[model samples]
Each structure stands twice: as structure tokens, then as C-alpha cells.
Target: MIYDQPKFLPGGDRYMLVEFGNEMNLELNFMGQSLAQAVADNDVKGVIETAPCFASTLIHYEPEDISFKDLQSEMASLIGTLGPSEDIELDSRLFYFPTVYCDPWTKEAVDDYRAKIAEKEPDPEFVARLNGLSDVDQFVRVHSGTEYWVASLGFWPGLPFMMALDPRCMLTAPKYNPPRTWTPQGTVGMGGASTCIYPVATPGGYQMFGRTPVPIWDTQKRFPQFENSICLFQPGDRVKFVPCELDVYELVEAQVADGSYQYNVVEYQKFSVRNYKAWVESLDTSARF
Candidate 1:
């Protein structure tokens, strides 16, 4: 289980995706997440963010500041630490809030967005009709309540893809079709034993169950921001979505606005030139950023 020489990445001029391969194996997932945290925890210079996917972890950084070879070396050295017994899971737990998802789109609204790619890929009408995904057996189980982990963070600031789900809850691909574009913000989804929600939606394709008002992103970070500043989910954390009441939702939103609210555990998009610009500007203005 060691990549002795460590896989070096092309790092396209500035960013790099250190691939572990496209295996959703639990071991790979754990390794990828652990390495990411180690890099971030060590505070690697020039490392802006690390995003872990099925089998790869992408690191966003300034190559001009730190050479690829050096970063790779750091990553290789980092693989030495990880797993359930290695660190404190981020105590991910539950925090409930309110969401209003009623296919909000009328036939007219659907037609308007139809030409756009966003309208085409939707949670299959059949899936919605049958409430299909919900019926999948609880695919995973846990010995006890453990906090979730922040596998990696990127895509959107504060938006950290998290971990910790009973296989029972883990979702497989296409028992049903998923929405093309979820609410700009209010989606809770579980992917392969990992449950997460887009703090603020832009465009994604994941199973949706409920919504919450946990403000994971802050738009004020940059003009024309894409729900900027997604409140990131970190590792060694526990998460739970609180079932919210209207009054609670309102109160939570206010708390988020004021920067005082919290969550037990909570946690994509294509982009145009404009989208890219917003992303760059929205980054935290400190460090090698």
C-alpha cells in the first residue's frame, strides 16, 4: 500500500492532481484524505488547497513560488501518516435547517433552461416519482457515532467534501437520475458512503434528500462570487443535519450572516472565463494565495 516513488503529477503549469487512480476503495479514499490533511496541516508553502476525489487529490498552488518537484517530494513524505487511528476525526455531527424544494420549476421554467446543459441532466423523473434512491438499503453501518473527516477542500472556498457515512447510506450511481442544477444552495446528498451538501449551489449531479441553511459560502469574498467561501468540512469531524423549523431557519441564516453559527457535520461545476475570474478573486487573500 505504498507508492514508494510517489506518483508525480503534471501540475498543469500551476495546479496538480496527484492521482491515486479512479478506485472508490475505502483504503484509497482514506489515504487520499489523510495525505491532503497532512499537506495542509504541515502548512506546505504555496499550497492553496487540496481536493480529493475518487482516486486523486488535486492540489492548487503557485508553481512559480514552489517547484513541482519540491511539492511532490513534500507529498511523498506526507504519505507516512493517515487512517482511523492516525488523527482526530473532525467530530462531524448533525445540524438541521429548512429547505423548500418543490421542483420549483414549472414547465415554463424547465423550457427556459432546457437549452442549457443544466436542464438536461436531472434526477430521473422516474427516480423522483418512485422516491427510488431512498429505498436503497442503508448501505453502511457504524460501530458508534464518530465525527466525519474533511477529505479535501476546493471547487468553492469553504466547500470541503467530507467523509463518514454508513455504507447503508452510501449511494451508488444512477438507481435514478439526479438534478442537473440543485438549488443555488440547499442540497444534502450522500455519495459512496460520504454525505455532503453544496453550501451554495451552482451546478452539480448528486442525489438530493433535504436542505439546510448552513451558509457554507460567503459571496462578499469577491464580486460576482459563486456562493463564495463555502464553509469547508474538515477531517476528524462529526456531522449531522438538524431538521429545522422555519423560525430556526431564519435564525440560522442570520447567525451565518453574522459569522456566528456552527454545524455538527455538514459540508461543482463547470466554469466559463467569467467563472474562472470569480474563483481567483474569491480566494483567501493571505498566504501564498
Candidate 2:
């Protein structure tokens, strides 16, 4: 749920955390993103950077330039100037990723967890049952049916926390009780209602079901898309997971190895929240893919 007004709290001396709400919703994120964009556009004097999260925006500032109190005041004033969530327009890029669902890599990881940690159902099967899908195949169909919204990047560099843009495609699962020691890089999974692709091998708790060979993060700057930043995605980007077989995954993996992987992207599209809401209203919310 959205708060009556955003709450302003100081993060030590260098940062301020502005929260739109406690719940994870697109409306709340839009409010935070809109404010973040406003800060950037207006050239807020002391603000160094703004990181918008699922429900809040963390602002880094130079205390020497402006006091925390003054920064809060400035942010509050800027928030007043912004019209509504529907009025927000942001540049969004679409990326198509070839994903192999119910693949061996994540299966091996899940097997290892069951052997060492505790006995539990396999990740894909467990998630499918939990969501009342007929089977893992149906789960994959629903999961890959719609484009996902890139709400924020965090927990790891270039790691996106995304939500289904289509209501029928939403799937939720709980995280691992004793988190896995390591997760394969490019592994795609979900915790709660958010889906994430691990940028690199790291300890994770999301229920893993799919793996993508395409690199979302590259420090070596292998791809042309990584020219601006090491991370391939920005907040508000859209992602479509194209379900594929292991053969296709290996082919793309090989291309990435030699630095010839061409990114499938539609760039520089303006996303209008007003049009998005209208589209959502026209859908059958009770339907499933």
C-alpha cells in the first residue's frame, strides 16, 4: 500500500532514504522513480546520485554542500511539483534473453541443497505446485509468456528485481530456508512475486528454475551494450525470457565466450504509465497464460 506521503529518513551522514511505502507495488515504484528523475532533471544541488528501489529511493548527497534538513525540504518540494504516477514517462529498453528452463544446472544445485541442507521438492516442481499450475511445463509457459518490468537493480551489480508486466503471468514462491552456498551466474529464479537473474555466481535463496547464457553483467566490457556501464540493464528496462533448449543455450554461450554475442534489444522507447494502466484494465485479471 502507498503511504499518505513519502517518509524521509536520513541514512547516516551521506545518504537519505525516501520511502513511498512498505509494500512492493508498481505504483509505489513509479512514485519513487518519478521523484528520482525529478531530482536528476532539476539538478538538485547536493544530490550525488539516486538509487530507486522497489518501494523507496536512496539518495546520496554531499553534506558539505547542503544539510540533511535542507535536502529533505528540497525533495519534499520537488515531490509536490510532480503530478501523479499516471503522468510519469520514462525511457525503457526491451531485451530478449534465451532462457533454458528446468535445465540441469539449477537441477544439480537443487539436488545438492536437498542432499546437504534438508529434503525439499525440486525448485521448478515446487514452484509449479505452489502456484497451482498443472506442472512445470505450464509454469514455464506462464513465466515466459509476458515481458517483465525491471523495477530496480540491487543485491548485486546488474541483478534486476523484476515483476510481471502481465497480471496472468505473476508467480510467487518462497526463498530457500538455508540459502544455497552458491548460485550459477545467469540463473533466473523468483522469491515472493519478484523474478531475478543472478549476475554472477553468489549465495542466493530464490527458487531457481532457469538459466540464461547471456551475460547481464560484464566487467571486461565484452559487448557494445556495456559501453556506458558494466551493467547491461537500468531501472525501467523490460525483459522477455525466450524459452529455449540446452542446444540453443550452449550456442549463445559459445558466442559470448568469443565476444561475438549480439544483444537482442529494442532501444529508446518511451514508456507511458497512463497507457500501461489502460492496457492492464482491458485484460482479464483472473485469466492465466
Candidate 3:
């Protein structure tokens, strides 16, 4: 179906999905890339934004500005003219992220992850590099995940999507428990080989072994970045998880609360949602904001 013109979604007028394939395979991912590049490279009229994932591209537009039919035809025509994908070379950034992987924060053991080094504390840099996604053109150096790609941004503002992790470096999921509403801001955590930040202090579900200083999000600013980029990571950018000390968190807390800061509430609320959408969304279900 790589050569086939993209099909229109029968039910929707506002948006349509360009599906690459049914299975999550490598070849399909390439095809998806080709399709995304075609649309991005083409000079369409009404497209406001376009986002690419591992195997699909979500194109957003104002239906009134340009009819969906016309957009589809243009995309189809460009697909044929599109060029081969250049390698996805990500920006290279190496930095340290602060973390507090200790007794109460981290469990003693989780199934096969039975290694104890709780004498003083584990290394602050828990990750050497992360890797799972290798679309080449979007993120080629992500072989070891040392370099990460922003795949999908959602669940909170400024929370960028880091591409998937290597099957080997992945740790088992943490024990099931109720998400905390206020996980200390910049909590560093992992879930099913994926690395994420709580962005701010809010309730969370993933195993939060430590914390970070790099603000995951900031809504405190008068205007939100990327309009509505839920994650600090984006669909094609890379991130370096720098570690910090617990004492540093205390200082940041003070700075955030100070009136002189720019996006105190913005960062907190955005990441608060990122901390646990389940909880916040639940509030909506119960008529609570």
C-alpha cells in the first residue's frame, strides 16, 4: 500500500490518519516516514500542524480553510514526487540528570531485577543512554537511546515524547499502586523501557526512582509553547536527562514560588497532568476540576 493514495476517513471531516501498515514492523515505519515527508515537504494550503509517530502521521488542519478532499488529493500527488528519506540525525547533547534512587523511593527488588546496591546510593546517572526507535531520518543515533526522539507529546503540556527504549535496558513495571497527586516536581521515572519525567510534583504511577531539574513543562508563561505541546519533548527533537541533587530541588521550589519567576503555575499544572492523567481525568468524570 506504499504506492496507494492515502484513503479518506469516512467519518471525520476535520482530520484523517495516514496509516502505513497494520503491523508495527520496520518496513512499515519507513513507509510511514515517506508519507509524512511527502506531506511536510509539499506546499499545502491549510495545514496548521503535522505530527509523525513510529508508524503513522497525524495531520491537523482547519477544514474551513481547505477542504479535506483537496488536501487529500495534494498529499497523494506529492507522495509520488517525494524523495528518499535522509537519515534522522538528532541533536547531540550529553548532560547529567539528578536523581534520588533510595529505599522508600525505589523498591528493594522487582522480580528478576534482583540487585541490591543500597549501601550509600546508586549512581545518579542511572542511564548511560536510551534506544529503541531507529527511524534513521528522525533519530539515527538512538541506537543505544543515548540520543532520544520526541515521538508523541501528550498527557501534559511540555512533556515531549522520548522514543521507545531498547528491549534490554527496559526495567520491569513497578508494583501497582494508587498514583500520588503531587510527585515532587522533576521526578525521574521509568516504565516498560520508557524514560519519563513527572515534569512537576504531582501524583504518578510509574516507578519514580529519582528526580531531575530540567523542567518538563511550563504553562506558567502567558502563552503555551507549540500551542499545545503536552510534553516538553516533541515529535522530532532529542533530550538529555540531567540529574540533580535533592538539595537542588529545594532551591528550585523556592525559585518557583518566588513572584519574580515567569512560569511557576504553568510548569506545575502542565506536568501535574503529566504526573497522572488518570487522576485528573478522573476528577472530570466526578465533576471536579
- Candidate 1 lDDT trough over 10 residues, lowest sum: 135-144
- Look at candidate 3 and tell me the lDDT of residue 65: 87
Which residue window of length 10 is worst by lDDT in model 2?
23-32
- Model 2 ranges with Cα > 4 A deviation: 9-15, 42-48, 61-70
Per-candidate clashes, comma-separated: 54, 0, 39
TM-score of 3: 0.51
Q: Which is the winner by lDDT between candidate 1 and candidate 2?
A: 2
lDDT of 1 by residue, 1-289 (tens): 5343446677678787777655454446566766776887899998988777645778888887798889887787777555442233333334333442322322233334455544443332323333233321211111112234445555555554655433222334342133455344656554444555676655554445455666556545321222433243443333544444466767876876776665433331121324433544675533210
Can you write out model 2's per-residue Cα lDDT over 1-289, one digit (the tens) per residue? 7888889998888999999898776798887878899999999998999999888899999999999999999999998887878877888999999999999998999899899998999999999999999998899999999999999898999999999988889888999998899999999999998999999999999999999999999999988999999999988899999999999999999999998889999987899989999999999988887
Residue-level lDDT of model 3, residues 80-198, one tens digit each, is: 56544333333322223334443233332221133322132121222222222223221212222243334455445555435432322223343224343445566555544445666
Compute each candidate's TM-score over C-alphas. 0.56, 0.91, 0.51
Q: Which regions of candidate 1 are displaced past 4 Å?
A: 1-6, 25-30, 40-49, 52-55, 61-67, 81-94, 97-150, 174-182, 190-195, 207-209, 218-232, 242-289
2 against 3, candidate with superior lDDT: 2
lDDT scores of the candidates, listed in order: 0.50, 0.92, 0.46
How does model 1 score by TM-score?
0.56
